[model samples]
Target: MSIAEERIDRLHTLAKQAVAAREFDRSREYVRLARRIAERNRCGLPREFKRFSCPRCDVYLRPGVNARVRTQDGHVVVTCDCGELKRYPYQS
Candidate 1:
């Protein structure tokens, strides 16, 4: 993977660890920083990492805690606690 991709992957892993430890703010910081780095490098974030945050609020989402996920109409719909909704197309 490219340097930017590697950095993003590392950040996502750290974010997951932070969220698991109930450190949501730390997770958010990690996500934000990762996103900034990706943007700076003109690289898109992988789908795995994108699933961890709300596009609008930019906050890390923990399913069953701060977010709800549902698959509908061939899409994955993510609803954040802040009431932001995001939908990603499903392949199957």
Candidate 2:
């Protein structure tokens, strides 16, 4: 894989572990890093996408465009612009 891809993969993995361990703060940081990598690599996501929503509508504040941030601790929930914050289970 390309360097960007590799970085993204690593970041995702770390985030996942952190989430599973309940390290929300760490997971958030990793997610933010992953999002930066995705943005730098021009992931080709839809323009109107804007952000990602949690599957459960508990928390809707992700660091990337429609990104699923995760770690070993658990998942960081996100609120959807749809008016409800949701919780989504994800893997880093």
Candidate 3:
């Protein structure tokens, strides 16, 4: 992987750790930095990274903590505390 991709992966790990430690603001900063790096390098964020982060508030979502997860029809719904909702299709 490229240097930017590596850095984004590291940032993703750090953001998850920050959220687990309850340092939500730090996690948000990490997410924001990762996104900026991706934008500058003209690359897209990883699918796992994108799924675990709130696009509207840049917060790292922890299901049952800052995010609610539900399955509706053929898709999974993730609702962030900031009221942002994301849906991803599932095989079921």
Candidate 4:
């Protein structure tokens, strides 16, 4: 069967127990399943996840253990080997 159909079937079965007992853990599992199904169907996320951005350059921010920054104007000036800060937009 199709991924969406499979997810819908599982969701239907899980819905009863998930709602009846207010089982958040089980409900979360269902949510994950839904996400997987959406991905499989190329349907995309219901909502995007929030991401941090760079203040000085108005660029996308990516933090790493080895990355260093200089502090200025209450914000860190990020310098990368590529000479440009990578921007990561919200994706769900």
Candidate 5:
């Protein structure tokens, strides 16, 4: 992987860890940094990273904590505490 990709992955891990430790602001900072790096390098964020972050609030989401997860008819819905809703389609 490229250096930027590696750094993004590392930041993803750090963000998860920070959230797990209840250091929310630190996790948000990590998410923002990773996004800035991706934008500067002209690359997309990883699927997992994108799924776990809130686009509106820049918060790392942990289901049952800051996020609510529900499965609808054709898609999975993730509702962030900031009231941002993301729907991802799935085949079941």
Candidate 6:
């Protein structure tokens, strides 16, 4: 893994911890920082970390809490708390 990927992994872990602690704002900050780092390095976030955030609002998503997750029509649809829907296709 590249340095950027490593940083992204660490950030995602921190984000999850903050969200679990009910510190939504702090989680968002971690997400924003991870985004900046990825942008600067021209690398995308790891696939496992991609679905846990709202790109538009920078919210850390917790299914059944602040987000809705559904598998439909061969896609995974993630609806953020802000009502923004993001869809990702099933690889297989």
lDDT of each: 0.86, 0.52, 0.97, 0.45, 0.96, 0.89
- lDDT of candidate model 2 versus the reference: 0.52
Clashing pairs in 5: none
Q: What is the alpha-carbon RMSD of candidate 3 to the true structure?
A: 0.7
Scored by lDDT, model 6 comes in at 0.89
How would the candidate models be sorted by lDDT, starting from the highest?
A: 3, 5, 6, 1, 2, 4
Worst 10 residues of 5 by lDDT: 57-66
Candidate 3 lDDT tens digits, 12-54: 9999999999899999999999999999999999999999999
TM-score of each: 0.85, 0.49, 0.97, 0.35, 0.97, 0.86
User: In candidate 4, which residue pairs clash?
Assistant: 60-87
The deviation in Å at residue 82 for candidate 5 is: 0.8
lDDT of 1 by residue, 1-92 (tens): 89989999999889888878888788889999999999999999988788778777677788887889999989989898889988889797
Q: Candidate 3: minimum summed lDDT over ten consecutive residues — where?
A: 83-92
Please report how far candidate 2 places residue 83 from its true position, in Å: 8.7
Regions of model 2 farther than 4 Å from truth: 44-92
Off by over 4 Å in 3: none
User: What digit string (tens of lDDT, one per residue) describes model 2 on residues 1-92?
Assistant: 67877786676667656656656667667666666777889873222222441323322244443333434456655444344544545566
lDDT for 24 (candidate 1): 77
What lDDT score is found at residue 62 in candidate 4? 34
Model 2's TM-score against the true structure: 0.49
Output the lDDT of residue 66, model 2.
30
Model 6 compared with the native: what TM-score? 0.86
